[model samples]
Target: MFSGLSAFPLTPMNESGIDEAAFVRLIERLADASVDSIGALGSTGSYAYLSRAERARVVKLAVEHAGNVPVIAGIGALRTSDVQALSDDAQKAGASAVLLAPMSYQQLSADEVFGLYETVTRSLSVPLCVYDNPGTTHFEFSSELYGRIAQLPNVRSIKIPGVPANPAAAKAHIESLRALIPSHVTLGVSGDASAAMGLNSGCEAWYSVIGGLFPKTALAITRAAQAGDMKAATRLSERLQPLWALFDQHGGSLRVVAAAAELQGVVEHPCLPLPLKALDGTGRQQLAVLLDELELA
Candidate 1:
């Protein structure tokens, strides 16, 4: 069903390239924490920057070391053939499922978007998670499109980003998505800041960045929300607000989390791709204080 707390671990790197040793250590930590699943090659993993072979290697590493946790590999690309080939490779590497976003250099039409999934679905035996990340993909899915894609064969889940931070609006949006999609298709939310509210709104899963670094804490909140303890969930969510504010101010979690992971000694270096900078000294100082205050450090 792909429900519960799915951690999106950072792809650690050293001077030569991907730090295989660090990658193994991080995955082992998540497994030790009992995260529901592991998502390798996700946005946090910088799937786009790596070569095809590098991505394949990352998936192989994830499937091997993630310790019985289902690995969801990202197979998104600008072209259909590349996506299909990656999906095939992820399946060969023993990934439980592949995540896809309709990323394009030129804008894609609705039919094009539908065709992309249809093509990939036809080539895969495993299920797919439709990644509706408009912020990065530059392609948005309408409610009708959600219904249409939910009908596609082997489309098991929808990973929607930026579910409103407000609990009321988040609930309404979740309800609308529930009404629009088939019951078989589970709804997963991805924004770390809004995740608690989104889960409270009845999302089946949380594809989380923070969970990668602190799965124990992430699981605590998810378990509380799942157990119908709103008070506990809200309190936990409030604890994360400081970090969430940094994410908001910086425009995303990738850089902020990269810094936090390094500061907490989870990763050796931030090692973000060009043009994307990690938090400065001041930002790290602030993050350190927040992590300590929230007991995340």
Candidate 2:
């Protein structure tokens, strides 16, 4: 069921806590854009930074307001019990599925990774998507491990980081993933920059960052790629190049999204949680030029 474009919302924050009003508005905007799914507390949503109670609140709000779209709650945590508890909270909050990553304090083995999912699967009735973001988790999953996890009960999707930014390598990588996984499970690509290539190469979905803030544009590109109109998708991606450049230069998309959302007047604060500051003034100014070039300002 996790197919097409999935928008990973940046949890809109303010000093008082999650800006519920702003959060609601962002969700409604995504729904209006007709994104395929809404990931309420994905990485872009800063799942790691929020308290358990705060995460539950976000899931509840997302499911309540997501309309017909599926709300997939991010249930990843450092400990197994915490992940299971969060999974329960997500189910109780009426999320359609839980996105799980093998987040760990120390390096994890493939067996440990499998064990984590095995335990979570036993506890959760909702469908689970194995989130393979090695960049953040410091855990990696080979195609062999993916098949093993896919065999587990209720494990329905795998959201993996996109291939190397190079187009040919990305295409080959996606084809290999398609060849590895069973037809029952969907393979989604997470890196927003390579989403068009992945979609065109038969990956079922785009777990997107920009889509969270600019779902209309994201959906447009997705539709183009899915319709076999690479030219159209390329045009859209070109327009988005400057934004993606900042993501490459700044280490990741969180700070960039924070700035873009505020630049577009979508959120009250461009800030992230402590230790992860918003883009500095110079960075914001640079982003503003790019956003303006894209007509987002």
TM-score of each: 0.96, 0.96
TM for candidate 2 is 0.96
Query: How many clashes in each candidate?
Result: 0, 0
Query: After superposing candidate 2, which stretches have Cα over 4 Å from the reference?
Result: none
| Structure candidate 1, residue pairs in collision | none
Q: Which parts of model 1 are misplaced by more than 4 Å?
A: none
Residue range 123-180, candidate 2, lDDT tens digits: 7789999999987898889998998899888988999887666678877887787677
- Cα lDDT of all candidates, in order? 0.86, 0.87
Candidate 2 clashing pairs, residues 3+ apart or interchain:
none
